[model samples]
Target: MRHTGADARTTLQKGFHEPVEKPKRFYKTVETTPVDGGFGVLLDGRNLRTPGGVRLVLPTAALAEEIAGEWRAQGETIEMADMHATRLANTATGAVPNSREATAGQVMDYAASDLLLYFAEEPQALVERQTEQWGAVLLRAEEEARLSFVRAAGIIHQRQPEESLERVRQIALGLDDFGLAGLAFGAALFGSSILAIAVQRSWITAEQAFELSRLDEAFQQEQWGVDAEAAERTDRLRSEAAALERWFKALRT
Candidate 1:
């Protein structure tokens, strides 16, 4: 079934009593309990599902096609080739085991049951959700940093707007995910570099580039440092960018 997760939980939750298909559940120490009539497998991610996105964790390509219709398809989806790579243990030599010694199908069914249960009740869909959120944080810091530099340049002299905006673009693309603060600092430096490029291209004067360069230097010293909570570091980044902007103003006068 193609799951859209339209009604998925807002955050990761453990409301499901069943398991989901995840590579991790194949081989981990667990304490099982017999309930109702069927076995209750002890797994968390299965019950908790994803943390943020509204997507279900699909098995990789190999697994998806392999178990397309078996009802026990999800586990069968992950080929031994893939499972071997992922480090699952105590699997059937040729198939999965339900408890001790069963055909691959039986083992596959148990695994599948857990997998489907997880998808039904989990939170976000994938790990990318976290990365994207962090990415947004970094992107915001960069935008404000660019704004400050442009303002400083205008206050110092009759700076051209098109040239400054174009410079900001180059730096924004070059930012690496060292963390939020690193991303912000990288963006500030990128802004400076873009201004330098404009200077080199005769788009802006060399003096303009030199003026922006002071802000870049300040980013390296202050905004670039790692902080304890990671996200909180963006405040420091903003402060540093502002400080550098001030320095640029002083230099201009």
Candidate 2:
């Protein structure tokens, strides 16, 4: 007899005999080749295309190989979410090309509420941790981007200097579409334009940038027990950070 949806799930959870759906193996092999301007990926001997149906021609051969490697690493079921490198390349090649200015503007907008600009209050330890970890990154931004960011002692809102904002905007405008995409990812992941710029400039590695971003949360987690939901969110952010790091490394090669 057939069971209801919940009943079937309960039965499966109870370890009753049931057939499990196996993952589908879509492609047998993946390869890469040099295209006219960049490189493309071939899945089972046919060139792969983006979701938008455009031929996936990445700007660098290294990037192409990274994307191809993602495809080749797929298990029986091809999970698009697992293909972070390919998705990032698709954004760089397709999305960013048509919206470079907008993307740069988005990254620049993060400067308004950049994580480094906000500070914790009360506890001296947390405050000092923020100062020690985030302050150095801010100094690096001032030196590298020539943009001086104002800091707040607490949650009070503060307006950054107009000239500083414009200077930061100009720096963002200077980056190419590929660079802008990576910067946007890094900035959004860490919620700090300064950390993102530092990552782009090699002032700090992605792992260090993440650790800096989560300093306050890490402090609180140590004081209190960890929350499963918060841990999951941190894991996802770390994964995104690593993906952006790989993309940037590919661009450098």
For model 2, the superposed segments whose C-alpha errors exceed 4 Å read 1-25
Give me the displacement of residue 166 in model 1, in angstroms: 18
C-alpha lDDT of all candidate models, in order: 0.28, 0.76
Error of 2 at 205 (Å): 0.9
Name the 10 consecutive residues with the lowest summed lDDT in model 2: 1-10
Off by over 4 Å in 1: 1-192, 195-228
Q: For all the candidates, what are their Cα RMSDs to the real structure?
A: 24.2, 9.5
- Number of clashing pairs, model 1? 15
lDDT of 2 by residue, 33-123 (tens): 9888778899998888877888887778898898988888888777666678887777777798888778877667777767778888859
What is the overall TM-score of model 1 with all chains considered together? Answer: 0.16
> Number of the top candidate by lDDT?
2
